[model samples]
Target: MNTLPKPAMRPARPEFSSGPCAKRPGWNPENLSNAVLGRSHRSKIGKARLKEAIDRTREVLGVPDDYLVGIVPGSDTGAVEMALWSMLGPRPVQLLAFESFGKDWVTDVTKQLKLDAEVLDAPYGKLPDLTKVRKDADLVFTWNGTTSGVRVPNADFIAADREGVTICDATSAAFAQDLDWAKLDVVTFSWQKALGGEAAHGVLVLSPRAVARLESYTPAWPMPKLFRMTKGGKVTLDLFEGATINTPSMLAVEDAVDALKWAASIGGFTEMKRRADANLAVLEAWVAKTPWVAFLAEDAATRSNTSVCLKVVDPRIAGLSADAQADFAKKLASVLEKEGVALDVGGYRDAPPGLRIWCGATVETSDLDALTPWLDWAFASTLDALQAA
Candidate 1:
């Protein structure tokens, strides 16, 4: 019997799950000490804190002056649903779905909303042909697919003179990528992703066009209070001013403010994007040298800088059955977990059998650098364990 030699370096923080990603480098429990807990969210101080969250988000993201940003219920999902249910039925919808979250939106529009929709879907690692998308139809898509690690390279495919609105789910892309605000009418994200804030609340940004669509159109179906953003055929401007549609957690609100302040302290979006890019570069360098791993996204342009998904390319592992490959990937993750080198690096449950590493802004590149050798060690260790069995 031989003992596997453990890697010398370890990540200072091992909280790498994609959604509730690693918190900002210096985050501490004390950051939430000023939270207005045990108080009414509608109160003056609470509302001010919520408004600060919205205002800081706008300032950090460089959102245009006329664009309205609001805090909504249900995190990113809530914000997206609110937009879809409110404004989708007015025009023909074209949904581009390449991953699980995008596919979920397709299901929502086609099944739940029952709108006149054209769903353009592709397999896990690929994107739908953007050139083929109808220019006149309302567009809905994820800017970055967390599960697939495929991100739309840019907004060039969208027509500049298109008649309808473009709704974007940018939960994982917001701070990590450049968003063409002129091309997107609606953008939604949660605090949990790139900002590394607490979840439960979603940030919804609306262009003038999106506001017009909401005020002009009414859905045939009933809009739950949770999904309601309009009142009496008018977009509620109060929502943008920190008047939430429902009760919100002031504690979460304060945590979000802390995260946003951290973002601003570090040079805002450019710094965030740079950090994510560097983190992904760490994996890209390793993958380029290691023949065993390949990016799940076939095209380099479409590969995500946030959730970096990788597939096993080594013939010894790739030759196995799909279930066996899945098991192998799980074993690789378990080995790293047991060694306390990494956590939650497994592929999404519904995604292809592989590993998904989060490279969001909140993660330190040095941590990723330390984790890389551990990944190689874990893979080799797993292979040995399999052979011994």
Candidate 2:
């Protein structure tokens, strides 16, 4: 039996998954025991820390004064759903989709919210045609699709002055990429992505426009207890200021605090951006030398720095059945996994056949370099396996 050679490259630590990514801040996990976790979140101390996390996050991310932060329930999904269910009635709704999370939003808009939505979509490897979207429509979009490794490079296409609101699901994009605040009316993210915090909480940042819409426009459906954000038919300022309707884990708040504190210590957003860019550079160099490899997303500018998707280009395997392609990718992923070269390199369940290596902010560039040669060997051995079959 032939085997891939062991790679000499080694990260300062092991890495490669998208979320629950390798811990960068390097806070002592043992410190969790000393943290105040089991206490009720409504207590003064709990709310204070949670408030600190929200405020510090704003400072680190440089959110504008007009945008208010809400510690909402659910991870990124919950925050996004709340925005969709609460804010999409007065204007025409446009759903921009390119990947799994974007597809989820499409389902929510058309199926769950049951709104009359015009879908501006591209396949897994492409970007939605933003040029054709009705600029005045209330738009819901995923800034970065973690599954497909595609992200919108710029927000210039979004009209500066429009009647509609732009609600963005920025879960993976929050700390990993720079956001154009002027183009977005609402942005939501979870602590679990680039921050490496607990998963139960989501951070919802609402621009003045979103708040205005909430006050002036109401959805045609019942406001469930979880989704309710209004009181007296007005957008409550309290919700944006440490008055979360639901209880949150205080420890999670501390973890978020630690993550944000970590971000600040590492020279803020610029440093995080640098790390991500450098890591992607490592992947790009690796992808260049491999003849059977190419980006799933065609354009370099549109391709995500956080999650990089790669496709196998061997002509013999290219025309194989879908199952065969999947099997081959899985075999390669498994090979890397066993060798400790990578873990969780498989494509998301909804995406096409390929390896999706996450190169988020928290992930160090050295790890990406370490994982590449291992990939080269894994695919080579897998091809040999396929030929034997």
Candidate 3:
């Protein structure tokens, strides 16, 4: 048996799944000490904490003053579903699906909602034809395809004066990418993503247009309390000011506040994005030199800086059957996990056989640099071990 020498450096924090990503650099359980755990969310103190979370999120993200930000039930999925169910029937819809999440949304619109939806789909590592999208129709798309590691390079595809609203599921892109608020009508994300806060809640942002749609046009389907943003045929403005439609965990709210404050302290969105970019740079450099691996996203311009997916390019691994390739990828990830160098680096089950490394802002660049060498070691070891077996 050939024994591979272990790498000297390891990431201090090895919690790198895309959702519930690595927490802020110095996060500890005690950070939630001030949570109003045993009180009503509508109570004055609890409301204040919730409002603080909303206010800080708006400020840090530079959301336009006209836009309304609300804390909604469910995580990113909940927020996205709420928008899709409430706002799609009034107009024709154009849906883009390049990854699993986007594909899920497509199913929701085409099968569930049963709306007049034109779905534009791409393969695992590519983008759909944006040119075919109709400006007159409502557009639904993911800002970043977490599963495929592909992202829309810019919002240029969205017209400045479209007739319908643009609903965006930006769960993975929220903090790391620059959102064009003027070009978007509905944007949704969860606290568990780029900000690295606790989950069970989602943040939904609505443009004035989105609000108008809710208030003026009611959906044909019955709107549950969970997805209801309007009351008595009017937009419930209180939801934007800390009045949640459902009970939320005060502990999670406090953690979100902590994450927002940490974001502001580190120079806000720009600094957070810079940190993620740096992490990606470290991995990109390594990928350029490594012959055995290549980015899953074929276009460099569309590659994601956060959910960085890489495919096994070595002939030995890449040439294996699909099931074998998937198994091999799993074994490689397990090798790193057992070595304590990385964790949760496996590709999404529905995605192509590859490794998905979360390079979100909370992840330290030094850790990524340390982990890269370990990746090389793990690959060599996995190949050697598999051949022997």
Q: Which candidate is the best by lDDT?
A: 3
Residues 1-389, model 2: lDDT tens digits: 55667667755565677776666646677645545577767677777777788899998899998899999999999999899999998889999889989888899889977888999989988888889767789889999888888889989879988889999999888887989998999999999888877888888999999888888877788888888888888877777777787888777777788888889999888888888889889988888887888899888988888888888887877889999998888898898888777888888878998888878778877677777777878888888888888
* Cα lDDT of model 1 by residue, 67-170, tens digit: 99999999999999999888887678999999999999998998988776998889999999998877789999999999999999999999888899999999
Better of 1 and 3 by TM-score: 3
Clashing pairs for model 2 are: 306-359
Candidate no. 1 TM-score: 0.98
Kindly report which residue pairs in candidate 3 clash with one another: none
lDDT of each: 0.91, 0.84, 0.93
Candidate structures ordered by TM-score, highest first = 3, 1, 2
Candidate with the greatest TM-score versus the true structure: 3
Q: Which 10 successive residues of model 1 have the least lDDT summed?
A: 1-10
